[model samples]
Target: MSVRPVVRQLFRIEQLVDMLLALTGKEISRLQQILRSGTVVYHYYRYWWEGFEAVTEDLQVLLAKFPDADPSQAFRAEQCTAAAIEQAETQAPAKKMEVEIPREAASRKRLLRARSLWECLMQLAHENIPAYKTYSYGRHADIYVWEILPDVRGRLEKAVERFAPRELRAPLRRILQSSGALRLRFFVPR
Candidate 1:
């Protein structure tokens, strides 16, 4: 089934925040080195490492508006809680989750301090959490949507719906031609 646009947009933000939280672990230095070394096979995917860091910096700016005492701790707590819930359910042999009980050992694996952010991300991804997602931009290599948290999707939709038809075709054309996307083209998630 297709995901609703609102859910997709919200999940995108949640995903980016999760990644940033993973990046803040105690062994960040080691994780950073592992990330910089190209975690993927192809040399081109190495761009992802730099892209992840750059996106983290940008996401931090976006997060600054909604300050929290310790988002990383909160994120870890949420993960642990979610794992516990799943593990609890797995104890019921009649439940469908019995097929997957073996992997739920993660619920009991509590660490006082995360030893590697990269490893944490890998675990999250293995659990089907949206740690990161990338797609080709088509026109230009690839574009990232590193979770511009808040109701950016809604706000942008309203802005476009409000501005698109009423505004002239000439001015937008001139801006697109001269400035080259100084003003972003309207984005409507399908």
Candidate 2:
């Protein structure tokens, strides 16, 4: 077996590894953006929940204006009804429960995945090519700048910007700095 062919094979393998690292970094950045955005939405709902009590009270008062109303008939007839009022009240708690539980769960899962990817990127950064680490953060910035659907990303960006600093921002920034990607903007401004 010739040494030249073996060397060529090794070079190809190294290139392949490099490519995979780039892709992984990009994926990490994308996931970070997503996770951060999800965090924003979670907080928005939390804030909404905070105001929900007042909203429910107001709704109850509005329904009380029509004491003799059949809530189901009101809803079905586009008028106020007791049954519809009851149903709305009953559903409010369930809706709130759904919002709190699933949104939080999904947000947490996205954060976990993003953190795992960040850890992987950090590990890769410690290797010979540190570019991947920088690339990872840059890719996240790009997704925030581009790619992300505007309406959704706008709300997400706002939510993430509002919620991130206390949670993941500082740690992620420190990690990026440690990895030599100091110029990367991973956190949305508070």
- RMSD after Cα superposition, model 1: 24.5
List the global CA lDDT of all models.
0.29, 0.25
Model 1 lDDT tens row, 29-57: 44345445534322222223332343445
List the candidates' TM-scores in order. Answer: 0.18, 0.15
Candidate with best TM-score = 1
Cα displacement (angstroms), candidate 2, residue 15, comes to 14
Tens digit of per-residue lDDT, candidate 2, span 136-179 = 22122211111222343344334333443344444433332231
Each model's total of backbone clashes: 0, 10
Off by over 4 Å in 1: 1-20, 40-47, 50-84, 88-190
